[model samples]
Target: DTAVSQTPKYLVTQMGNDKSIKCEQNLGHDTMYWYKQDSKKFLKIMFSYNNKELIINETVPNRFSPKSPDKAHLNLHINSLELGDSAVYFCASSQDGKDYNIQYFGAGTRLSVL
Candidate 1:
């Protein structure tokens, strides 16, 4: 089984709409993160969670939020989505929220806002 999995592998929507991407990890990891990959393929960290506590929240718009109800799950919610929000969102997790720790990533959710 995949260590990390994200639902709605492909999402195509219009602007000004709200949407969410669900993510889950089965690796029993204590740290989870949300990342966004733009058209140029640069991955940026959006949010990070360790043992259900928010940490390392990057400079993202208020429209974006990471909801972590538990240690194994961290979902991303985007409100009033804009055209610029179109990109691939990835969910990742590691054994701990420590530097140099190897993180396992999901296939990614491709979001297209037309």
Candidate 2:
């Protein structure tokens, strides 16, 4: 079975709408991350959480937030969506919040703003 999974593989919403992408991991990892891939294919880390505690928040816009209600789940919530926010969002997990650890990635959620 896949270790990481994301719901709503494809999301289409208006510019002012709010939406969320849900992610869950069954690998028993303590750390989870949210990453955004822009149109240019540049990937940036948005947020990181360990054991449901947020540990890293990168330079993402305030409209974008990561919420982890438990160690097994981490979700991304976007407020007042915009065209510039359209991109591929990925959910990843690792044993711990370390770069050296093997990270498992979800199939990714593609968001489109129209």
The lDDT for every candidate, in the order shown, is 0.94, 0.93
Each prediction's number of clashing residue pairs? 0, 0
Off by over 4 Å in 2: 97-99
Candidate 2 residue-wise lDDT, 21-111, digit = tens: 9999999999999999998999888999999999999988899988999999999999999999999999999996465878899999999
Candidate 2, residue 38: how far the Cα is off, in Å: 1.2
Question: lDDT tens digits, residues 65-96, model 1?
Answer: 89999998999999999999999999999986
Which pairs clash in model 2? Answer: none
Consecutive 10-residue window with the lowest summed lDDT within model 1: 95-104
Instruction: In candidate 1, list every pair of residues with a backbone clash.
Output: none
